[model samples]
Target: MKKYVQEATDINVWTSLKEDTFDRGKDIREFIEGLELIEGNAFISLDAKWGDGKTFFVRQIEETLKYFRAKQMETEEKLLKDLESYEYLKESVAVKETTVEHIYLPVYYNAWMYDDHNDPLMSLLLVMTKQCGGAYNTKINTKSLGERLLAVASSLPISIKKINPATIIKDLQEGKMDILSAVKTEEDIKECVRDVFNDIIVEEAEKLVVFIDELDRCKPSFAIEMLERIKHYFDDERIIFVVSLNKEQLIHTISNYYGSEFDATRYLNRFFDVSINLPEISWYQKQKVQCTNSERFWITLIADELSDYYGFSLRDKLIYKSSIESLPRDVGDAFSQDKMYLNIFEVIIVLLDMVDAKEKKAFLEGKSNILIDLMPRIEIYKKYILRSFGIDIRDDCEEKLTEKYKLVQEVYEYVFGRDTEEYFKEADISRNLKEICIKACNGLKS
Candidate 1:
């Protein structure tokens, strides 16, 4: 019944990195460690396809940076003693090792969650004020921050509640005051906002790293506005913005906002100083080295093999795994027992139905060239056959492997072919195998 992958919590991030579960932890830590060389304000874009673990990756980076910040503070004995009271910090091996050299106050913001706000800049400022203030235990001057925001609000052409521009014009016309003197220019407003940001960073850490996630998921106008606001107002030496998104989706969003003819790539280039693609997961390599006879291991191996065959994204693989896991206990046991090939085909049919019903229909209608084409190409079935029959591929002849494949293909045709009942009656395959395959397929559908 699990519908979605869990969001990365602090403990999840720490544990995953500690275990190197996805095998990218050392690279992630090294990437954060390299951030120490950045000298000024930077806008870094971490690009990945949707559901390619961008959120998790960025969260790990944020946690790693926080660990570095704590380590930096621990250089002072009093601060070290204070940090000892935080049990979470004690759990991080990175903190104990001091893997990163620089300290950056990190703030994570979900842009999609805040897209409903009136202003992206205001929402971002509030997040910075809260996250940085709470993390470092630094007392922010809320009154001063509020006053600065109000100052910017008042000078703008937009209306604020109860502020009458007509009254100001009347006063100016009556020679009561100079309207120009009261008005703040664009540069003045930018400086005011910059000073507010500086106030938050100066007392907390040497630099502020704001990790903006889900930007591509927001409304196009809001996403563009966020980029513009960062470029204009946050041009300071002590701030870094790490925006994570799918660049292709963001480009589509831009095209939706601006006309399709607009140069979104060039426009996007103006916002980011550097861009990095999330590293791909090495599923095949990992699977080859995995040594386990557990049901989950085989299930994961099947999912990984099929995922590569179909070119599934990380998210797709997760959903496929979940689908397999949702099957009955007996169905899973069938995979680990005799006739695993039949059980695997049932799983494949279910996956085809889930991912491409038209293809599944085509496959069931006896136009199984698609599935047949895959039989010789996939190594999982070959490995399974070899393991199940106690035959080593290294010592076996090519003709024998071909005969085994022919036998599998014959079973496939008899079970899933058009007029399957006729073929089922004629084939020598066990009635129990047919019953199990049918029951599994029906169970998964239900």
Candidate 2:
């Protein structure tokens, strides 16, 4: 079964996703190596946008850790029913289980919690303790973290519940302290947060990781809180924080967070030793569109769909072509030149960028109903120019637009050394725009 699911709340059910097959082998292996190191946090970005498989990768990492953790525990025979249910069992009580390959326990921190700057450091500690098969009972000391935070939890700010940070840190460390209140000092909060990670590594001897997903989704205020928390508090050697965020949103958020001091590079550099950017899918990515008797529409359509891009995928081009080409023949064999040209003209103007070529074609064909026009080889090239360009020329308009389009093609070739961007860019666009307009107006005479 696939490691992760699409839903945010439920953890039981997992759905298979196609993205797991991506061939990022070397990078994945290097990350695994980094995980094996017992000290210092490794901050790594997944390098993908919101939907391109960030969750799946996180789940995979979690599964790997859970396996290692399970293996480190003592034998099953030693885990007698009587000893199995304890809050935080001391390492002195070793399990008697046989040698296992790995453990897969991972503590996931919800990204939504980032908004509340006053979030108790204790709640997070509780989660890490649970991940280690230890319950959060009254056995840890928390006074080292302070007491003012306890008051914040009782009364909320802006209806957002604040928890005492010291309570949880002490809980993780001593597993014997029963402090119910919070301390208000920033130093106390930082100490509490850092101690949780340090205690997990030094006391429990387990790999510590913090996975923060969806930083891009939160309000700017909450987003800034999250960034600052990580920078100031979660910078422990024994802990790793994996956060997912978008660049543009992050810029806006941090700009608001730092106002005049918005330097995206500086903020990231403070904590992230290595940062990587996930790239958008390039135009060359090929996808299947349709099949016909003679050949299949198996090419990237990017170029045809977008009117003013330097380049687009074959899928885009095909999709845009469909807008005009998808027309069904007029019923009853009424193949008039005027009617066919009119149908072609309908798709040329008002270039819509968002819709895929297939959808555009469907709309035009469904609306125009001009199939017979396509089959009759009646100087369609000339018709293409007249309707596509808003130009009135004698019978040889194709000769004109084609010439114009080529001029664009020449400058493009000079700049890129080839038709790299395809029919995009202003030069080529002006010619195509005129052609489409002319075609719509029937040789500019309509």
Candidate 3:
């Protein structure tokens, strides 16, 4: 049961016994330690494919804040400087900036509304107020500076309500109650933005490390706008903006929406201070279980992870292997008959990658998008085998990339003929490129 399998035999990638979750490894520790030291805005990039547990790490931040505050969401100390997490008003910075601060707290989660970038700072201001436990006062938006303050005053005591209707109106004529003293128009609301930081510090509690998951998730048109907002108005080092981004997704979103007006990396280069890539490492449980079957189970599990990471689906590697009365002849071969009939992905990835772009595009239009996208990759692989090692056709491309690979001798015959030396270019393989190709080959193989 312990063996490598091709993608053709597999499906449903999630069922692998190998777990994918954040476990606070060395990479995470290093990144956080580095992040804690920075004084100004910075940029960091964590390279990871989807499902590699980026979100899990962000949750760790939230957990740290919870521990610092003893799980109290709104303790008076919740707004304090030393606390791990906090909330506050714009008017309180000077008092709080000495310790933990929330200068112009970022309000940057788009909830999939990536197009909402035009007024990101304004949108951010709205969200920041909410984050600090402040409610949106709808009526205040329409009122004059004095009237807005009157509204805040009106919310205070029932006594004010009792005296208000006619007398309060009369007092307004006399200019007795300066209701406008506290707050005012939209501009003034923004003016109150800095107070949130001061409030958090004076509270003498933990600092709130707020992570805005993915500003990059927003559309490119809004990306620069959003970036500018973060750069210019709402600047603070203590309030960390932890982002969860897949680089390619960020790039595609940017190019599609922004017409390549700005380089995504160059633009993003300004924000992230520290980043750590979460790798898909071996998923073996280190704790020794004395169960009799533990060794067997562990062996099978490790094989499963290796297979999955190499592009085999759980269904193909496990379920189909055990089922299907007639065993798949040459089950995991990149070009085996049973595999070709059972799953189409293996063929598709190769065809798409090797074919002319226009041809690939036309084929993609006529075929399933999944297969279309997969085909090109497969073709690049097949062509590489043909061109590099002269191992075309039945001779798999990946085998040439591996160290001491196991394969039928016929594979070599089909690829480089009897004389492997005529095409195997020793000088052509640079160490750097060799390792990369080797890993890529291994990824495709097992």
Candidate 4:
């Protein structure tokens, strides 16, 4: 029998602390604290490019809110107990409210993960219904909401099985069932659902904080529906929604929906109370020396060599590094030499916008001839691709792609001599190269 243990640094937002190197987590917590200080429903957006870890940041926000809520609940409980004991000791009964300020029940809904569903409203309702029965007060009666959800879902045009309401409730929480289509003429349903949702929220907790994540990754229509539904149905004073998305992509999605002539930015303005952009990761931090692993060093070395022309920001350089780092296992150890790393990364960046995943994998992992075969394309990337993008890679002797290529060739020649290509073909350099790259890139960019 084997048991598994959780890794401490496994990218779990709940367990991980805010990285001091980045201010995103701190800013998000401040925003949440601001919301907690006030009353009424609020809509906040966490804006970042796709793959910038918006979900991770949102998870951190969720955990922080939960932590505060738990602490408040404990204080409230203790105060209530002390009050009761005092009343008993004095032989006089007194009544006082036990509710604490800013106690919230958080619901985390990944919108993109439910893209197969046609109804954003149903997806939200399902999650809310289940979350209502969670560790909060048992008197909240989410069971009624769950039954209502099932009834509404069954009334839709799809062919759903005769699921037990009990089973439906269980499955909904576990994400085993999806609530698909809504009945035609959804206004009545929307109002009814909204009423129930608001009632449950008000009765159960001080506020309902729903974090809608990955909206940018959802289908355009689905994403639009999510916003519309939130605005129209879930706009209770005690409800707060935190959405994570790439704002530019969302603007594009809006334009696609309402036509290119639509003033998407103005249109989108009404949906969010606050829009926070996650700052790009810094290449350097003040007062602290950054850690650079071996793999990151290789990527960073090349990126630094080209930064003067490419103008790759820390984020852009890291993104490019990710592409190179994803190269297959077969060519793993063949890219250690500083020159080889630079030359290979240069090629990958140029061809990145062209090659599909499979093609890139094949090209990277193809025998010892990988570098040699890529030699012909070196001139092409430097000439046509780089210059077309207004970049000149051969700025100085230090930045010449030709020199980098020559160094790689020389290294192979020195190591393998007459059988240089064959030696690389036979070489197995496989010591956690990806981990090395991550460490390097995590350090100061230079």
Candidate 5:
């Protein structure tokens, strides 16, 4: 007997850059290295679809940068010991550079988590103020710069929850409240903020690297506000922003900010200097087509057929591959030229999610015709299966339908021999599978 459990059994959670088994960390490191060569304010967009591991990729890069910075602060003996333990650092010149110009104060902020902010400046101020303790050992007067920025942030035209600036000052105790109390015009506030920003940039020992993530998931207003604030307020050459978001979704977010009639793509282009798409993961995308032995195609075909009985199994993929290879040359030759819709590796992985241990073992061992179980649910695999044979279900003719069945039967016989028909007939499998096929054919008629 097998039981379904809700808790996670296996997961390799990566806390640092070295644990990257997916080969994603190297590309990100190259990007960071490229960014280090430039000396001006710039922007980069790490573009990828949601759930494609963008967060993990960026976290790895962040950890790598922090590790390098921490190493620079270590004694020579300690640094050598650390290098011996972490092999990836041994070949890198970026980790060895001791110049203040190459160092950065990296700050990561998740925009989606702080979208409740009525004013984007307040959220940014909170992030900047928290780092005023000079963690990077820079000579920058971060405390004074933060206070000046806060005073400017408090007087902005944007609405905040607190009304009394004096009360805000008393409660926060960050700075005096009288920096802009006498100012009447918007220009004065902007000028005050701009001056403080310039001073902060000059005062900093190293450049500021702000990584804004999940911007597309934030409210349209909040997303747009964050972009506008960074552009107008943080325009110094010493600041760099590496933002992550889906380009399409961010354009849609921009559409919500402006009307749908606007050219959102052209408008959003002003924010980023360079945009790079993450390389596609093999499991999520189709593999590149290549010439290979027909045995490979037959192997995938067996896996697909097995899917009908076993649902799916990671284990069966390996077993099926071995089983198919062990078949006589003539049987393997029959499938060599045959086409298959699913990738053998991916198909097996998908099946693993759909079956249990006992069920998978029985089916893989050839105790049953799995097709009968899967026949009634053929619609699930119908699209891909039909595609495998260069079939379009919408164009079903009598000759075409017969040809399709002939091919299916040939593959069926190769697996189960003369008992193929008898295997389907058992346990009402033939009747049920037929009914589903009839319904599918009728769908073509309608």
Candidate 6:
């Protein structure tokens, strides 16, 4: 089955946000831009549950800042040349112009990817240097910074052998250094690190916005150490750190590192200056209506309804859509009456198998109430299913709605209940419908 993959590239991020699928991108971008008003070093946290698209949201903000930064440079020709591979941005840049005055240099670092390194500080510095090099087209001098890092690493309570010399100090790989005398004290090392950051800001952009993502996915020690490193070493007036993570998971990681009785939430609060929860997807929010004939439209609708009931993440919704797409084309025919309920069942079965296989197994094993209990109470899904049975719910009258729901329940019983086979035979319930659904569900599980 096709999996959901988010490409970490500027053009892909632009394309995804240009469509503004969630409709909250513009507002969130404006909020991020407002961070420029905050003086001194600011630490902001973008909190979301795992797989809820925190990474995508932050990347969208990153791209927006980069676009405006490019605009500030007045190098439209060079920008266009850089984006030559993505022709969509040629017109996009013109249409989506912002009047924001303050734009900071943005750097995205995936903390989980580099957590295996000896020091979070070293990993962070390397990323900042590399990204700055690409943005400014000039190599940054990290010799002094590298020596000081070695001194700091040596002084740190952690093992010095864990430090990867090749990655951090490429120029000093063959050179020898007395780590003891490189820096006098902790204050001296902090000052040197601050100077390095200042040099980067001076050479590249006036201000820096560093986005640290996936910290929660890192090891407990690594995650805690990263936060501590950021709080101590990278403090600067021209720098703003935006860290994206599932705060709950990070709290658990903290509790794991400390004791289970430790107050992880209170401890985590010390690291962030400001925290914002990533917006949850709301069904009531006005979304662009899809064409009724579109297969994707139906699949998305079904998955969305299930998501509301099951708390499926953005990733879960994508996976559910993919599972539905993997079925036989004949089984997916929307226009065929014989396949209408089958298509809906296929969508439901795929999701049920994903989230609650035990419940699905019980339903397949002659327990009709298992499926009935799991059915979503949303009006749109109910209306669509009822429409198949030639029942149109035109009014919101309580008695009529109740009667309609009972009809839906009876339809479920007729399709899934083994005992109702003889009773619903006159209603033209397909004899092979249950058998086909069971076979499909088993095939998916296997």
Each prediction's number of clashing residue pairs = 0, 77, 42, 6, 7, 0
lDDT tens per residue, model 4, 171-256: 65566665434444566567567666665565436888899988887888888888988887766777888898889999998999
lDDT (10s digit) by residue, model 2, range 1-446? 11222353223111211122233223334455555553556676555555544554565445434433533564554434433322122221111111223232356765655334343344455555545444222223344223333433333332323445554455434434323233456666666565545444544344466776777677766666556656666666666676656556667667776785779656655656556564334333322222111321211121233222423333343444454343333212222433433343343322333444654444343332222232122343344445545568656555676664444334323322332435534332332332333333232222
Q: Pick the candidate with the highest lDDT.
A: 1
Candidate 2 residue 9 Cα shift, in angstroms, is: 8.7
Please provide, for model 6 over 1-446, each residue's C-alpha lDDT reduced to its tens digit, 9 standing for 90 to 100: 55545565766677766666566555555665568578888899999998777887788777767766766775778777764333443334322644456757889999988877766776787788778766664436555455446656555555656666544576332223333234568787687677667656754476789999999999998899889988987778788899999998899889888999999999999999999888886654422221122654554566566665676676666666566655554433223544655656666678768888886666555454643454446655665656655555665545555564565456555677666336463344466666666565444321
Q: Write the per-residue lDDT of candidate 1 for residues 1-446, one digit (tens) a residue.
A: 45545667767766655655565665575567657778999999999998778988888778778766776666656555665333554454444444655568889999998887667876787778767767776656555555555565555454545545455434333445332233468776677667677668755387889999999999988999999988988888888899999999999999889998999999998899988888877876334323232665554566567776777666666666666666544643343332455546766776797688888887666466555567578887677667655677789455666676666666676656646345354334553454576666665431
In the range 227-270, model 3's lDDT, one tens digit per residue, is 55565544544455555677777776766665677576654655
- Angstrom error at residue 130, model 4: 2.2
What C-alpha lDDT does candidate 2 achieve relative to the native structure?
0.43
Model 5 ranges off by over 4 Å: 1-16, 76-101, 131-204, 282-446
Q: How many angstroms is residue 284 displaced in model 6 relative to the true structure, after the best TM-score fit? A: 6.8
- The TM-scores of all predictions, comma-separated, are 0.74, 0.48, 0.43, 0.60, 0.54, 0.74
lDDT of 5 by residue, 256-322 (tens): 7789899999888888888888775553211111112365554445454654354222223333344
Superposed by TM-score, candidate 4 places the C-alpha of residue 376 at a distance from the truth, in angstroms, of 18
For candidate 2, the 10 contiguous residues with the lowest summed lDDT are 291-300
lDDT, residue 230, model 3: 60
lDDT of 6 at 206: 67
| Candidate 3 global Cα RMSD | 15.7
Considering lDDT, which of the candidate structures 1 and 3 is the better prediction for this target? 1
Span of 10 residues, lowest total lDDT, candidate 6: 284-293
After aligning candidate 1 to the native by TM-score, how far in Å is the CA of 276 from where it should be? 2.2
Query: lDDT per model, in order?
Result: 0.69, 0.43, 0.38, 0.55, 0.53, 0.67
Q: Which stretches in model 3 have alpha-carbon errors above 4 Å?
A: 1-22, 25-28, 39-47, 71-118, 126-190, 199-202, 255-262, 273-446
